[model samples]
Target: MTTESAAYTADIEAIAQVVAAVEHSQQHKDPDEFLALFHPEAVWTTAGGKVLIGLDAISAFTREVLPAADWDGKVTYEVVHVFFIRPDVAAVKVRQRYLSPGAESEGAPLYVMSRQADGRWLLTACQNTAVATA
Candidate 1:
């Protein structure tokens, strides 16, 4: 493989790790860890349609809801696609699933991540949509 290809793969892997951390934080209800993955000026639109602008708003919403979420099992997030808008920006499509004793549901979330000057990726904008069944 070319050096460029290798570097790109490494970058994607790093981004995947960040995404995994997001899943971890949510499943474990650790708001601090989840909030740390977002940029200070990030925006998030929840699955229920509440728009949170900036880290403070996001943190408030997450802290208030995540811990009180009434899921009997765990939540899992998987990266389904990754589109690079630029060398420093990416649009990630994620499949999120909640599994419990006798129920399951899913959501599709699009997360826009930006690579910081320090080479770490932080989520900058995101939208979570519930997967409706027909």
Candidate 2:
């Protein structure tokens, strides 16, 4: 593979890991592990527009919500447009589809992500709209 192709492959894999982390945390309800995917100072917006800042908030929020989640699903990154803001700092805009619990349904949940200093992607915002189809 060419240099560009290899870079593309790496990005794809990284995005896959991001989705997997969300699914895994949801299934296991492990907030500690889930919070590890985010930066210590990360900020997020909930579906209801609640603002959460920092890892502590992330842990608390995930712990509360994951247990109540009826849907254990994945966020497939349909489009991940990336940019390197600085040499070691990068950002991405991802369009994702969140499958319903048991991986059913034709609707997509809204999600936004940001990368941590350790090179991991974390959900910065998420919102679920009514499924477009049954």
Candidate 3:
């Protein structure tokens, strides 16, 4: 589990569940559900380029934005890649699709997740970037 290969091979499904939860929370506009996926000192950068540090800031942002989001419960998140920094840490790339019919868009989010003592993965740091049309 110390080598990169072992780390990469470990917990792929478990880490994916974290991303899946994000999709679900986003689709449902459930701030609490989204907040539960973060580490206590997690950092998140929104697609709009706002930087939020710690759970408090992340929580505040999510509470306000998620509830007011106009996605209309149509969205999906897929883990496209995962690179292990350690046995308990991974850098995950995700494709986030805003499935709002005619106005569909996509986001490429990179999440640095860490496994907790209880073996649960939480998002430790992340940057969400919008995929602009050419």
Clashing pairs in 2: none
lDDT per residue for candidate 1 within 17-106, as digits (tens), equals 988999999888889999999999999999999999999999999999988889853999999999999988999999999999878899
Whole-model lDDT, model 3: 0.93
Error of 3 at 18 (Å): 0.5
User: What lDDT score goes with residue 44 in model 3?
Assistant: 100
Indicate which candidate wins on lDDT: 3
lDDT of each prediction vs. the true structure? Answer: 0.93, 0.60, 0.93
- Consecutive 10-residue window with the lowest summed lDDT within model 3: 1-10
How does model 1 score by TM-score?
0.96
Ranking by TM-score: 1, 3, 2
Displacement of residue 67 (Cα, Å) in model 1 is: 0.8
Off by over 4 Å in 2: 70-119, 122-134
lDDT of 3 by residue, 1-134 (tens): 47765655558989999999999999899999999999999999999999999999999999999999987899999999998898789999999999766788999999999999998999999999999988
Q: How far is candidate 2 from the true structure (C-alpha RMSD, Å)?
A: 4.5
TM-score, every prediction: 0.96, 0.60, 0.93
